[model samples]
Target chain A: MNKVLITGSEAAALGAKLAKIEVLGYYPITPAFPAMERLSKYIEDGELNCKFIRVESDHSALASVLGGSLAGARSYTVTNSQGLLLMTEVVYHAAGLRQPIVMGVANRALSAPHSRFPEHGDAVSQGATGWIQLFSENNQDVLDNTIQAFRVAEELRTPVMVNYEGYLQSHTLEEVFVPDQGKVDAFLPLKRMPALDVTNPRGVNTVAGPDVYTDYKYIQNAAMEQALELIPKVAADYNREFGANSCGLIEGYMMDDAEHAIVAMGSIVGTARLLVDELRKQGKKIGLVKVKTWRPFPAQAVNQILKNVKYVTVLDKNIVFGVGGALATDIKANLYGQGSMVINGAILGLGGGKCGVKEIKEAVDHTESSENKNRSEWIGL
Target chain B: MAVKNLPIVPSGDPGALVEAANYATWRIFRPVITESAKVNPIVTLYCPDGAITVDESGAEVNYKLCKGCGICAKESEGIQMVPEYTGPKGVF
Candidate 1:
């Protein structure tokens, strides 16, 4: 393994480089700009032989990568908050076309009161676009999951979104062991182009009439469902090669016999884990559940994991405004009528404001004491 | 490219996540806009504190009226609004 002191953005760039990406199509956005900038410098210095396309907008950036993938090139890009939203249209198209493109999303809040801090709103917004969504809880997971995402995407012929908190992971530098190039090359072969034969002129991005539209949509949904099934196998294969396995919808820490659990995603789970350890020493039976994959819902896995718990608190960085926390709603949707008191705490941290270990501990403690059910409370507002 | 005022759904809507997710999912099976579709451009305004507001129709009319608040570019969906740094002949 190659050792490098890298930020989350650089790790993603290095991961893609290891995957032997042939095309880098990107537009700069806060918290995600450094990755693309590094790739650009690499290309300029002849360190990597890749075609880097600088687009005018994020939409064009995604569109260009999709086009590049169709031409049998391994393409990658990075985006965040507004940038992710800007590319929303093509994000869906890329997945629907079953193009095995990989993207890194720096999670941040959507605008109105625009902030550049970390939040799940941006990445979670695209959860239903048929793109496989994976949330990284730390800098290391960011690197590993990003590399694995490409293999999973290629296997399923669907796009994958590897999400990390914007400033938290993107800007924070960490020590990471970069994988060996030769080993990576062996593990991740250059993706073969889909059977696009010039001999047969076939139209892509065609307008389907109503008669075939429904069937096509059904096929897309089936493909996504297939991705959910195939991800674990691919992740397992990855583990065999690297001796590190990090799959599954939710990763539980000290939850085997805990009565109370806290469910969260992205880098905040790291903070929660530390808090869990501190609380454990004080004889508190509290555990933490870090959600790695937010899409394909992972409803069954979540339900099964949290089934025995008496009270569960879900901390969501993004608010749905009128209703409740986004993750909380999803959890409730899946665990409806389960007789568990699940409290949804919408916390304004690292987005609207800075959130640290102290605030996270307070939220967990508050939820542990409250007997509220089906109620959503905003924390640190 | 040009700024315009637009009414936006409040940021506090809890359903925005679900709604945005649904819209994105539907886009996978359908196009964002059908043929001959009419779309109104919304200008995003970015404030100093990172607050964003969408102006659909009636914020400011003149290109010269822009104070470079950046709220429009930061808050607007699907595009980044930045000052035109290049000459008209130069490509972005």
Candidate 2:
């Protein structure tokens, strides 16, 4: 392993290279484009043995990667914002077909209002598309998660999307510890399934008429359920193999004796981590739960961590329009009927808005008070 | 009233008349060649002519009645429509 100063995109590209992916199919889209370039450079330099397929649209990028995956090649793709939305159909197709294609999404806000900033809206909108979603808190996390995503996807036979804030993580440079390719290979299993052949032919994804359509969907869901059990196991194994303690379904900071908890995902969790340190000095019993795995939901791990806390504040970077925040709804659903604990959903940092120390403190302050129990509201709007 | 006796024809003894009628039978419209079934079995259900048939071996196409409409291979995984060879002169 070597220490390198790199952006999230660079880290993501390095992760793909380390994973020994065979096909790198992508179309250029901001924040994510730099990662595409990084991977292309590695391929061009002959350092990484991979086929780089430049496609006309995000749809073709994912489609071609899925095609490559069907041939038993370990494949990957990257996109952000509109590109991710454009490839949404193929994204679902990749998951439904059980293609273990890993995608790196430089999270950005959707268009119509038209802003080029970091937002969880892009990736969060695809929350229920049957893909394993992992968010990163920094450049190192981006690299680590990207490497882990391949294993997670391969084990589950479902596509995995590693999402990080667009400009925040993708453009910002930070110190990252990149593991050796040999180590990554040992940690990740060899390519398996969807093998194409000529000597003996067999049909795959041929058809699912009414007689068996729901059964296929049920199987897909069962795979997702299986993924929940495997995620923490893989993380534990990654930690053991790499001697790094960065992998887990959720990373808790000072939650042992805390009366209140602040829950969030992605880069914002990094900010919350800092705030948790500051609040400790002020004798505030506020802790933090950084959600690393979003799909397979991580409800069991989250519920276990936050069960004893009296008040919980969920900081969501994405909103469900009229339905408050998406992560907030998930936390409420998970924490229901366990205790007399109050859950507050605080929507913050949408469309690249900054989550200041004051905003977090106020959210924490509200959590301690019984005034807005179970309320979902906006912060720093 | 005298009971009217229905004409009873033996299953296989109908011969030339049966063969003539077989030309217009539903079996004629069914697919006998199944190269497309190698890629997608759904083609068996969507074949407008209902000429598609799938077995453990794969799709079998009845080229004699298959009009080569090309719908069987539509949206298929790797199924293709190859040109049929009619052979030399008029050797049926």
- What TM-score quantifies how close candidate 2 is to the native fold? 0.81
Candidate 1 is graded, for docking, as incorrect
The estimated TM-scores of all candidates read: 0.78, 0.81
Instruction: Give the top-scoring candidate (DockQ).
Output: 2
Candidate 2 lDDT over A103-193, as tens digits, reads 9999998897998999899988899899999999999889989988999898878899999889899999999987877888889867667
- Which CAPRI category fits model 2? incorrect
Residue B63 lDDT in model 1?
Answer: 34
In candidate 1, stretches whose alpha carbon ends up further than 4 angstroms from where it belongs are: A350-352, B1-92
In Å, residue A58's CA in model 1 sits off its true spot by 0.9
Candidate number with greatest TM-score: 2
Give the winner by lDDT: 2
Question: Mind giving the per-residue lDDT tens digits that candidate 2 earns over B1-92?
Answer: 33223111001221233244554343312222444435677877777665566668776765434556778666565556654443684653
Q: Chain A: TM-score in each candidate?
A: 0.95, 0.97
